[model samples]
Target: MSITLFRTLEMLRHVPREPRKITTSELRDRLAAANFDVTLRTIQRDLQKLSTVFPLISDERDHVFGWSWSRDAQVETLPGMDAATAITFAMAEEYLRDMLPSGVLELLAPHFDQARRVLDATDNGLNTWKRKVRVLPRSQPLIAPDVDPEIAQSVYDALLNDRRLKAVYRPRGREPREYDLSPQGLAFRDAVTYLVASHRDYDNVLMFALHRFLHADVTDEPARHLPGFDFDEWVQRGGFDADRHGEAIQLVAQFDMAVGDHLHETPIADDQHLARTDDDRLELIANVKDTHQLRWWLRGFGPDVEVIEPAEIRDWLIEGARQQISRYADASSGR
Candidate 1:
């Protein structure tokens, strides 16, 4: 019997028993009524298969025939995911190509293939999906640092087993630091991967870029599932306004109308608030952690973009502009 037939039997097994015992003819008619196009014999074979796994009964006195499961019985059931879920899965597959860790896709490939087969067998042709939908990753890909697969695998294993790790991390322009850390989780962000972990040396949780890791080894050290260290909360804390100093800061900036239009088209913050002034200038406010990255971004706009808030940022930009002007002054003076 087809997987669909098996699924139909499984679904029928859950339906509450009626007063009357449903006969094979009645069951066949029900299947036909639902456009199953299968015979009673096939359904009977399916029922027999289910009987081996579940508690199936036919009562002559009540003239009732149905299947039921005990409360303690572990039902090994597949998800009854609809066509929308399948389409969504297919769409997600495109993003998974580069975003997910390597080898993960291969593990899921067989399941996708099985789903396609089941969809094909349905014969109703209800699984038609738009093949035109595409996701074009940014043309200018972010510079991804080389991550050792063995180290990444080790980190993954530690997170999976709820174990600790000894990580030797080398921050940019800084000496390497070795630490014993509890592997909380791994995440992909800003076109790079990071480990959200808790260091034994530090009382607070930290985000360590995986690329910056010089070496990592799984330790027999037991992981301390700390109090109030929620992974989701920790990840959300790394949002736009999160700070390098771990303090939330407001970032405000103004741009010319033309530059404002570009910013509107491509937002810099996930939750940026944009407003248009009476003079047609665009004002943007966001919560940001690292102003250094934002400074570099605004610099690309030349004089069109201005930092309106955070006196330190404004002063830094002014000094940078002065250095640029000094360079042009010497060129113009031919001295």
Candidate 2:
């Protein structure tokens, strides 16, 4: 292709769908970055000419003129949206809409729209795959807490650009405080979104609930990385666990045979061994991290499971049961 064709095509790609737009200056800079090195006046002239043939519009209402593809434009690419790519984008829209940053999702709006159109138009059996499959959460779903859109965008930008954040954070049951945070990563657990970050000059990292930020602003200061911090490794070691004890423990528990049957297919740990005892009870032995999650899982089994080896865990369960019994006894007396 000629230089003109390439520049025009690159410029078109930078033009966002209506409501989101690119100024002539922004287009010129983007083109320069892409090695097109075009002038702002040239971009303006090209846009004016292209508007006659393509569904392009200029927003003259703004002080700085902005250009965009019309909201209902039917512009097609050289390589059209195929069935496979269409379905992948469709699935991303369905599953990842909540997890992705709002700004990123907005940028993908056009592709998502085209994906839906392609899937709806296809007569092949492949389009039916979306209807046949479903992803169910392992735990009961709760409504996600609402994070302020602008704050979320700021947090995302800081993390993406390796910059610091000035934030007013309110911890549960505590007064709101201001902090300069170095955002390391974002974690989405169940319905909550957390920003894994370190407070100014603090070596230790903490997870801040995104919804608890009263205010947030990205700063120009460069974010400092902890000497040996790896977000993935920290998460794997149960960093998010409320009662992490820093070491793995040998978990030995006994369960009623019928209730523990699922362990045969879905063991808690790779080293987990489940066997039937003479009394027809299920005995399980495994090496696993002793985290609050483990305790919660065991407690969820109630009378069906018993912690055998770890005296501390066994005592914990017994104390919990005793407290429950006492509470029930008092309630019965009142009745």
For model 1, how does the per-residue alpha-carbon lDDT over 1-335 read when each residue is reduced to its tens digit?
87696657644643322221345665776667666677777777776776676655545565445433332233232676556555666667666666654434443454455556555655554456525676777434554556665567568768987889998998779999997999877778656777878889465777787767878887667777878778777655543235643345677988898867866778877888999988788999987754445667777778988888777778888999999999999999996
For candidate 1, what is the TM-score?
Answer: 0.54
lDDT values, one for every candidate: 0.67, 0.86
The worst-scoring run of ten residues by lDDT in candidate 1 lies at: 68-77
Per-residue lDDT, model 2, residue 333, is 100
List the pairs of residues colliding in candidate 2. Answer: none
Q: Give per-candidate clash totals.
A: 6, 0
lDDT tens digits, residue span 119-210, model 2: 89999987897888776766666666777766776898799989999999999999999999999999987667899999999999988998
Residue 217 miss distance in model 2 (angstroms): 3.2
Instruction: Write down the worst ten-residue block by lDDT for model 2.
Output: 98-107
- How displaced is residue 167 in candidate 1, in Å? 4.7
